[model samples]
Target: MSEILRKGDIGQAVADLQADLRRAGYAVERTAIYDNGTRDAVAALQGATGLVVDGAYGPKSRAALANFDVSRLMRESDLIAAADRLGVPLASIKAVNEVESRGRGFLADGRPVILYERHVFWKQLVAHGVDPAAYAERTAILSRQRGGYAGGAAEYVRLASAMQIHAAAAQEAASWGAFQVMGYHWKALGFADIESFVATQYRSEGDQLATFTAFVLADTTLHRALKARKWAQFARLYNGPAYAENLYDTKLARAYARFAGEESEAVA
Candidate 1:
């Protein structure tokens, strides 16, 4: 018997809905939160299949999903290309992938994993003639804090509030995808624009990996550090001054060693 899936649901079933939606080319994020994005995707899928567009994944929707072939979500060739382009070892790239993403990219609500910069959004609002003094406390709270969001759905809820002030600027204020690259870096990372960057982020992990490659390639110092296997330097430059607090450099080194050992074993 197929389980019913609806908005507000969480866990493995929600994750499955996201995965099958992606398989159906619905452009939903694989995050386990059944937020607006998931609801919209479900609606889109239902409309296409001539089912009742209620946005609920019931028995009928499950049957449809079962018929569609699951698409390749990531490619080894893309990873290899990114590594080669950055002039870094595959193990090094793998280390970053493992350390940075831990193998998850999108939230179940079909949005890329993001940490919206509320302080940045507030600044943008103020610049756009909105009064920050009115939302002063909220702005301060958003600025000082990070990572309380349960999933992409929660992040989007916060983002929607910011969007009430300035949509484009709010979008620009968030870090997106498995790489957690800032949207403000879109131009620097070779994306035609922020929207294009966001779209790519919504597409798949492959696009995120490509963007990460572009980001690494754009920063000569970071690229050099990566090629040299300077984990501390790389982590400091990539992750900011707080890298030591998280022991990001140490984790990178350990991950690199593990990946390199696996590679060596594969060759042997």
Candidate 2:
């Protein structure tokens, strides 16, 4: 390898590589430099692929780069537009969506099922003091909890159901949408009256994504998940990133391509 590499080539490659690593739950930097972080990412990739653990960027590394797709990184254009309407940051929306359905349609098996077992949804309801029953004996409690306690459940479940998880709250059905909301917790977060809020704020579906993004970005759980770079752990925190990766295989690649631009980054 040459002492100096093409920054453009390196950046583009690194971005693509890093996107692949990210999809696999590896933490990688988006910079184009061949820094220590990049080396560690290379080593981890090599180990995962059963290749030589040399950190040097060479032919093997180049070939291996093909395995890492940079096209899956999050893009903020849509989220940014949504945030502008919602008065939030684009990063916040993108983060939550990344955590959720990875910006794809939700629902288990592409059907109208609830996606989680009744018991699971029940448990989540218990946490927020909101009941999913057809009728609520006490609408007052439901109302109080519905704002930031019970909203977004229907939509979340709808998305997860499309993904094909039988039980409403099973591990497989844990996550939903681009925000990967778990059960009724999303409603508890103040999105319960999304229709009213959207109307009041004059927003759209993009606002919903951005609002959720801000919620996740502000959450300690999400922050820790990003810092640890533990996709599996984080997935469980929301839903399963592994399952999500499988679900959004092609879409995620497109997302990376759309967001990463021409940068070359490696996935860990």
Candidate 3:
């Protein structure tokens, strides 16, 4: 591994490097292949720890990762783009981001915050041609009923296990990043597949917001709900039928009001 590792490289060396970066709190996955996610994480590490922002792995990055504020993943421009894409107010977009992820994506460890639902995984695997009865014993990670939320970075543990059974299915079952956009929406969001959708999560909050915008634009009803300030409808469409029980609609409305007020004042 004396050579500098860049995108398009592969092998145990790459995986090892990813492991080293992950331990240092970078979002590089241990996929044994150097993809764009790895490159971005490397570049982030480089810029954060004062190395050149080359997006390549070499001696400097290796030593720097163990030490780390990554470059900004989200920006005001991202929110504006999302609002423009949805034909809604920027306040609306900001409100959703705040409600879904407290206004930013990623964990303190630099990994995207994921919520891998067991029931979704169960159905996804079955749909992908893997029988759940084969090991119903592992209900924690595979269940018809959802409830084992480890939350935040720990959710990746459940994801890693399910990935072993079926990579694409596993990824599609989870809600990812700032907006918690489900990977199942990958195709409609314009990605080639779930793998690509999940990779973008590792990119930045802005990337996640872009996916969310795609999702809203594709679902006309959802888009209209947000545009009309129909918080209840938007919440139900976005978060499922039981949204009222969690007051997601209320939270969204309040957050929107706060941002709208601020934006209005700025205009004045």
Best by lDDT: 3
Candidates 2 and 3, the one with greater TM-score: 3
lDDT for model 3, on a 0 to 1 scale? 0.80
lDDT of each: 0.75, 0.43, 0.80
Ranking by TM-score: 3, 1, 2
Q: Root-mean-square deviation of each candidate, in angstroms?
A: 11.7, 15.1, 13.9
The residue-by-residue lDDT of candidate 1 on 57-109, one tens digit each, is 77556655676421323345566777888878888887887677635467655
Error of model 3, residue 222, in angstroms: 0.6
In model 2, which runs have C-alpha deviations exceeding 4 angstroms?
Answer: 1-76, 80-117, 124-183, 186-188, 192-203, 227-233, 241-268
What are the models' TM-scores?
A: 0.67, 0.34, 0.70
lDDT order of candidates, top first: 3, 1, 2
* Candidate that beats the other on TM-score, 1 or 2, i.e. the better one: 1
Deviation in Å, model 1, residue 241 alpha carbon: 2.3
Model 2: per-residue Cα lDDT at residue 66: 66
